[model samples]
Target: MREPVTELAGAGATTAEPLWRAATSARVRDLAWCTLAPPLLSAIPREFAALAEPGGAALASWPPGALAAWQRWLASADPDLLPPTIEELSALPGAVQALAPAARSLRLGRHAERLLHFALEHGEGIELVASNLPVRRHGPHGVQTLGELDFVWRDVARGGTGGAPQGQLVHWEMATKFYLLVEPEANVEAMAPDPCTRLQAFVGPNLVDRLGDKLSHILRRQLPLSRTTEAEALLGARVDRSEIYLLGWLFYRDGVMPAGLDALGLNPAHLRGWWSTLAQWAQRVEARSPGSPGSLDSPGSPGSLDSSGTSGTSGTSGTSGTSASASSVRWHRLPRARWLSPALVPEHETEPFETLHDALAARFAEPHRELAWRREAPVMVCEMEPAGASAPGWWRERSRGFVVPPGWEERARQRAVQPPRC
Candidate 1:
């Protein structure tokens, strides 16, 4: 496992403070690739790795955002367990089906970890040691605490030559982040080895949260060697090694891949989308076709997914000559939490553009309700085309965009203009 660069101790800094190092902006791209590749490669289109091996058949069904979310879950899951493709999900085993409803309901991050823990605990040939272990030491000044390790698992490595069994202990760290590319021209995008002047190329909505800070905090502070003593003592075993399991979704401008992104080492298949304010989304809906799908007074009944389970001829596939009129377009506002992966919208939950507009209007009319706008706000509009009768619950993106409060672009631009500061 590759380690992050270490920050040397400052004159009067405590051990933990000194461990708070930062990776150069360029490293973020490499780390992103490192963070993302395992999940992508491991995500064999619903455990169809053997089937998806040739001619990119697996890649066809695996969208970047969806695949990232799957792999993220698999990181801490049983190694032998496989992710099911959308098609396979239609007929899961009864045992899996029993858990499917709750599993499906979980947010992407938590869902993945939960499935992983279940798989590990139930699988054979390996023993589950511990999870989310906390370590602390009492100093004369006060109690000093190290953060939690996601898991401590013992790998039973069989000897190649039929020798004695070798059990290696590993302290695994896990995290998932979804960042949007804000400045494609920054040196960080180029993946330069030197420290980044600033953490502006890609960012979370808060602007302060970034790939650089996340990586630095993990590598420098979280996984430092100095803390190993306490970790091992708490676990009652010597740790052989530590590893970082990182996963992420890097969203780009919807419909348009910005210039210089290629230079940033971003996966070409990385997920992309657009954002706008609620008012803007309403305007777009009005311009396309007002009061679409014929009913907003009773938003309860829209369209239902045909029970056929076949990847039908219409909808996201766009085989129908619908031309994506507003009425033909199926839109949904993503849930505020865990909005990274393209939230797969079941056909039953989908309504017309008018439905969302009416729902938001009613929501805001509740008097005390507050609407907060942020770059990472949940006002994500997933513009999916209507699927024909055969493919139910399998909506595809005709186009996707985000709805931001006014002046978001200017704020992002202003941040981009400022030099990267160390």
Candidate 2:
């Protein structure tokens, strides 16, 4: 009999709490998807092996964090959402293989959306109506492209489980945001019209991307697309229904919850990451990886690094697993798109550094790094050494989380908010 697909990568090894199993746990799996689904059409079921050429590397190279992000993205496919029932998720090898190609490019966030599209298309009773449809209006001056409809889909069975109707069309607006919490006091004066819109508390790494501005754009510019003549000409009908599929992760310093987080209306299932300053990161890494200055490496802690195993999944409740003195750990620079998810280190992917200083130096030197980490850094999940029984010294990522710098909240607030340029 053929073996089941156990992880995003191929399955030539034993299935002792594989990455797939870790990501599919009942809690995080469901939580991750709460904010992540969107409706799109269906496609032919191609063999898993067929995707090896165009998208194999993208799928195979998904770090632990990206997979976690993917899981959360899938979790967004809950029944109450606007999509049809994805009955094919349980098909194991076929489902994984079919979805693997959706992540053809290394763009992590885009891949998650592609998988969502694939999942919706793979549903039992769903059909693709349109995607990335352009809406342009011919004004007195000339034809102007108002905006693009992210996706337009129809559920052949109407809706999942509820049996709403048949051929129900939906306009889906899918988005992902990674914002850090800040004090509303900083911009209380600037928020003239509505001083207390929840947007005051959360801001992106760059202050320009405020929650208020996004909501304003969606409600004003995006939602109105249905009424435009351009959309009607393209879709042949007014969009019967519309919904926003907004998915995101919030980051904060370790053990420091923002003052007004509860009021933000953020979904409880929203994923989180911790941050630390470069100095703090150096201290933690050194503390965790015990050894001489030159020979720095921490051995694997006891017990299998499985969520269902004895350790019970670190970084979930804002904690981490124990450090192994002899095992080696690597500090990886997470992709900006994948920061909201876990960063998994496969056995072959563990490139340990000689010191914490070395890791930070290399990461900061990279051009186009997330500028938000100027004073603080985000630490992605790292695996403890002696990977699995099959591959020693090959540290496999076991969890998804980050550690942030101290006093970031204050610094975030001190930065002046930029006025929106019309």
The lDDT for every candidate, in the order shown, is 0.43, 0.44
* C-alpha TM-scores of all predictions: 0.55, 0.58
| Residue range 1-422, candidate 1, lDDT tens digits | 12222231111112221110111111221222233332311222122222221222211122244335443443333222434322233345554465644344334454445434454454444456876566777789998876766666665642312342556565556566655556544443454333342334556654556654554455555555323678767777666555555555544432223444333333443334434456755654565443334211011111111121111111121112233445556776665442433333455556777787666555444444253432234355566654333334444344445555455655755654455433
* Poorest stretch of ten by lDDT in candidate 1: 295-304
lDDT (Cα, 0-100) at 278 in candidate 1 = 61
Task: Write model 2 residue lDDT over 1-422, tens digit each, in one string.
Answer: 11122332232213443322333222222223432221111111132112222321111011244345444444343323322112223334454455445333434455446645654554444566776667898889999998877767775645522455556666776666666656445443344343234454556665556654554455456656855678978887666565556666554443244433333344433444444455654564556435422111111121123333222212223224334343445545454533433433444455554554566555655556567464355445343344444433334444333434455445556542444311
- Counting clashing residue pairs in each candidate, in order, gives 17, 27
C-alpha RMSD of each candidate structure in angstroms? 16.9, 13.0
RMSD of 2: 13.0
- Winning candidate number (lDDT): 2
